[model samples]
Target: MEASELRRAVEAGRATASELGLDVDDVVVVHDSDRVALHLVPCGVLARVAPLGHLAASEFEVEVARRLADGDAPVAELDPRVESRVHVRDAFAVSLWTYYEPVGSEIASTDYADALLRHHAALRQVDLDAPHFTDRVALALREVNDREHSPELPEPDRRLLSDTLGGLGAAVGTDRADDQLLHGEPHPGNLLNTRRGPLFVDLATCCRGPVEFDLAHAPDDVAQHYRGADHGLLHRCRALNWAMFSAWRWRRVDHMPDRDHWRVEGLNRVRAALDRCGPGRPEAGGAGTPVG
Candidate 1:
């Protein structure tokens, strides 16, 4: 969406800028994608708009942010003055948040690991209606099955992914009994290092699952810092994460040249997981050898 169209949408969708205690003097497009983020000038607030289907996920993040704000967990807090409710306008859902300057320096893995642990602890205290980790895999499987949506994916790779996802589903279902609140994806892209500290953003993927699910997306050093993580589960989760991400990229491969590399990387991870957890290896629980 264009800046002008986004501004107009925000204006039409929610309370007036004055009522919401925002400065409407200037609006700049800070980021745009599936979600459009507008920087509300002078007020130092960001207005994020997304499709109405994202309403549930958006609200879930807001609630998680609220909970984290009260705890010692480091997280980007929602704008206190502005209500965090998902406001629906036309075909979009909007929410307001406080803007923070990027720290600019690379965040150390230890920092991310410690912050994630704290955030996970805080998240465990809050009970909200959200999808389980398996739901994510199921969603990805549906996308992989929908050839029309991801026509860019080769027939061979698509079939491979479909079979891989099915095996992953069974493996995760049988082995993972412990569930905890997860950040869903805790990679560097989602971390905003600010003056306060490395505060996590993009909580739309929050769900209940094993910590390994989250670690799959994190760096090795970060995972090392996080004590008591099961190496086997972490490996399995890594493959699952890669597969789901590859399914998403399959739909956008036409527009994203870099997606080809990611697709290969994801497939490689799947192969590794199968090798480690192939059938008859009781130690590898939940995964079987790759089958054509």
Candidate 2:
């Protein structure tokens, strides 16, 4: 996921698009971290060009987006210029999507909450055979447990990760009444403020969990407008989210943005969050778990 690797992935996406009969004059790197996202010129298409290892997740995203769009949900859509599926080229797996020309930079809290609730409402009713939140916990547990993935992780850090994942995983699992499809990680990064409104992208993180799980990823102020979301649950979920992402950052091959900084900052972040969730209320992070 370095710059050169990103260029290669973009090449794969460009080659794939050409093979698919789409016209592409140029390529813009929308973002490049764990994966390379591209904005194909003239085509008005956004391409998520990732390693072939992520093919399954890419496929899952396409299916989920199609279903959500069918339900009239506020989500980014698959590009009409190409087939609605994951396209492959060389070592990369590509999924083309409709690119919304960003209308504004900042998102109001009310607007953010409104879009999230609508997304949750549409996701709740969908009957997709997706993974539960425990699956994500299991993945994090395995990552920290396996030295191959996290060789330099200190023993104490490993223990912390396990404790957080175990406790929060159990907590999220204990209450199943509110379980439903969620955006998995609906942080601000995933939301696009377009003229049509805030449309969510990256359905690859979709999973079955409580609405609070999704709310945990949003800003604290946005939760106030969500009305019925369990505040306690959201707090626990936020801690869990930190742990989950912390484990990822610590992984040996994790190329997410600010890798060196986040690897340390993220684990410390989880430790601090865990202190807030202790004893009688000690907390909480999910999905057939994608090992991301």
Candidate 3:
């Protein structure tokens, strides 16, 4: 929704604002895409709005945030004053959050790793029904296979992605023995350095998977600090991550100009990783083994 439209929606939903004890002065569009985040200043609340169909996932995130908050985990805290229930305004589902100022500095690998490990530990204690990591891979594969949605992807790359996803899915089932709760995508971009220290945002992607799957999205130094991570599994997970995200980017390439570059780079990485461990390759066994 545009800022003007969102403002009107917020105005129409004054009952929601009152329920949250928010005295909204103004609404600034902080981020706009599949989800829209509006900064409600003076009220100090961030309103995140997504499609109405996303209510379940949005509620899941709030629950996760609530659990993490109880344990003092390094994650963005949900506003307790407001019920975390999804507020429906027309076609959009809105949720309110406590706003914090971004530090705007690059976080160190050690700091990022520490926060991630702490959050992961806390997440392990919470039991919530979330999609498995493979579900996401399957979704990406479906998108790639959908000719109407992915007309931009070349036929050869689509075949490569299908084959790669199949191999990676089988490898994950056979290789990973330490599957657990994960932050899904704990890269530096998702870690916001606030006064409360590095807090994780965007809990929408939380899933159950190999810890290595989470590390696959982190920097090498961050992964190294996550002691006992199987490097070989991490490598395979990284390749799978690249393939999945690459497919997702490709699916949206027509809508996002900047994604074109990253999509190509990610596809190249996926191709290289697949070639190394694909059937008949010397490194085929490497996918299931621990790195020396």
Query: Per-candidate TM vs. native?
Result: 0.84, 0.90, 0.87
- Model 2 alpha-carbon drift over 4 Å, by segment: 2-4, 278-292
| lDDT, ranked from best to worst | 2, 3, 1
* Pairs of residues at least 3 apart in sequence or in different chains that clash in candidate 1: 171-286
Deviation in Å, model 1, residue 118 alpha carbon: 0.5
Q: Per-residue alpha-carbon lDDT of model 2 for 11-60, expressed as tens digits?
A: 99888888888889999989886677899998888999889899899899
Clashing pairs in model 2, backbone N/Cα/C closer than 3 A: 133-286, 136-286, 136-287, 168-284, 240-284
Per residue, candidate 3 scores C-alpha lDDT tens digits across 91-198 of 667888888889878888888888988888898888787778998888888888888888887776777677667667667856446778888998776788998789
Which should have the higher lDDT, number 1 or number 2? Answer: 2
What TM-score does candidate 2 get on C-alpha atoms?
A: 0.90
Order of the predicted models by TM-score, top scorer first: 2, 3, 1
* Over 4 Å off, model 1: 1-18, 252-261, 264-292
Model 3 error, position 257 (Å): 4.4
Q: What number of clashing residue pairs does each candidate have, in the order they appear?
A: 1, 5, 0
Number of the top-ranking candidate, with TM-score as the measure? 2
